[model samples]
Target: MTCPPPTATLRPGQLRDPFRLLMDVTARHDGLVRLGRGPLGVYIVSHPDYIRRILVTHSGNYIKGPLMKPFRTALGNGLVTSEGELWKRQRRLMQPAFHVRQLQLMESVIVAAVDRAVDRWAAAAETGRPVDFLDDCIELNVEIVLGALFSTSIDPARAQRLRELTSEVFAGLASKVWTFFLPSWFPLPGVIRYRRAVAALDAEVHALIAERRAAESTPEDLLGLLLDTVDAETGAHMSDQQLRDEIFTLFMSGYETTATGLTWAAYELARHPEIAAKLAAELDGATARPRPTFAELRSLEYGKRVIDEVLRLHPPFPIWFRSTVAADDLGPYHLPANAKIVLNPHMTHRDPAYWSDPETFDPDRFTVGRFGTEQRHAYYPFGKGSRMCIGERMSQTITQVALSAFTGTFEFSVAPGFEVVPQYVVTCQPKGGLPLILRRR
Candidate 1:
């Protein structure tokens, strides 16, 4: 309980692939390690024990911290960046919209969006054209999220513009992370563009809110539900700015995560035909039609396992950051207040101690009665504890339904000598996008 945890020095340019380097360092150092030196050095914690400590047991002593300060600038005081009382209130108000019953009501919106995208994929399949699977998934998720929020209010052009603006904003924010040492007064193009993107997005979202406010009646959708939400204590309805912030938070959190998961799923399915056949068989036996209702889709046992394995292997949000509020010890090693802690679920998910044959594409790993308590605690594709993803149910539904529609109606293939590398950015995704050849089943 006395010696310090091993520290690994990061060479120049290694930040480009930090997750990979982190995995190597942490695995070699017994599930924990420090990178670099001084105040800027980061502590990488892959051990479930320390992760549960920071996120759950002693969650009160850890905050999203300075690591998430940039998001506050980009997204304002939304749930993702807000802390303490503000976060608690926002979570309470938002919880009901993602409830099981609410998500059930939104199934039609999810299915309809997937169907339209599949129709386009079908046309490409008939012509033997290779489709960018990631792009298709990204576009589909945008529709699903927007349709759930606005009912049928947002048209294609508006959706595309929103997508472009968000993409720009995220790109700008990520670029700024590497230049944190620079002065705020520095003339950085990314920061300037990020500011412009946020402004344009705010104008667009505010206009949408004003239209709903002036309407004779609001439609039954996420925006309408949120518009009517009143604080139990304050009795105050959400202001225009609050609604815009929540909308921005929901979109930023939802689309890319679901899209990245589906993209990895397709890549794995194409690479493993036997597993794909088993999944298709289960799909065929369980689902009586091309499209499954919410109930029918949940009954696909093997399909669910495939989804589980996909998430374990390719978690969308691979790593998250938190900082200590005061001095604390993780088992033996001690960390001072404001210590930058990087929790990498990507490493823990594949630890051989918790998983068998860690690198294999085996959905059966998630089959019934296979996991011990340690393995269960060690797996966290949706994160752990109080601040776990708010839209877990909605994200899973979108993912499962999209997988059903795509696999149920088509066959996926790749070039003979193709390879895909993982791109670790804001979200973990397949590098160079996934280009797959599709054919109708």
Candidate 2:
């Protein structure tokens, strides 16, 4: 005997601070609540038992659903948007790209990007100009992802153009998140902008793919690795369209989630200068001048905790969405077929039941004895279950090696009087980009 959940009514303007509003509702309702009206209503779930049930226990009965419909519109049927056999095949084909060997290769790319960032930061420090942490991270992740994918094969200007085109595409797609509830026939400005951006993006990506195919060389870069990979059962390479889908997905995932994550980490690091100082000392002691190799950087145990704490405070993918394939029971609540669902890591991470001083910035929470079973369930910035992010290892490595190298090179603190607000877009980026001042340590 289950019951219909309580509705958490929120006015349109409350979307301005959805993090707080949603958190309030979820906690007040005992971690299960409803939002919006009929047909467009979403059931928000934050409890660990319920989260694991939906994401792991009954994952087979869930599909990408309405939330990812817009992603499909933007990304074709990439792993993030695909379902059934197509998803399984694509996931298998792409798995090797994030293998241990590949992550080793990415470490160098991450370090190189950090070095380039350090050079720019040194200039900013000398001039005493505050840098927008979000903007800087966006640029940094773009460089790192491209470097890993194409390496020296891409020209700087060409990479910059890709960055520009990607931003256009992201902006257009973001505008559609809300407008998508409207009928497709409606000629909204967002849809128009989205189509135009998609056209330009497709042209650029397809042109690159065609060029790579025509070339006689098959290098060991990510693109080459992807090109070389074949379906084990079919022994067939991914079609050009599939490649485009995967590549586009990678750029979106690689750029938005990581860059936003680094921004939030920078915010907390800047806010707590004492913590930042300790991190700098730990990172400084971890590696040598110029750059920290992946192996040496990973040796810093404290650095790992800082990264975890950053993500715990600000999970990039704050909301995970799914829909029921059939009628199902989520804890004590009954969800009908096709019911929209949201598994909120943001609320779960900050739940007072799981975290003491949930609002406090604390890395020690993840220490040896502390981060046990409950904590694991409460923290999933990369998601959980079989559908968890494929690039999880590489993303962590990028955060680890890049943060260590950059912090080791220079000390950074948030500029005074600048309020850091986690602006929810494709991911959680600082609203208007948080400002931080780099100093010569």
Tell me each candidate's TM-score.
0.96, 0.96
Task: In model 1, state the lDDT of residue 385.
Answer: 90
Off by over 4 Å in 1: 177-189
> What local lDDT does model 1 show for residue 226?
95
lDDT accuracy of residue 37 in candidate 1:
84
User: How well is each residue in 290-322 modelled by candidate 2, as lDDT tens digits?
Assistant: 556777765778878888898888887888778
Q: Against the true structure, candidate 1 has what lDDT?
A: 0.84
Which sections of candidate 2 miss by over 4 Å? 15-21
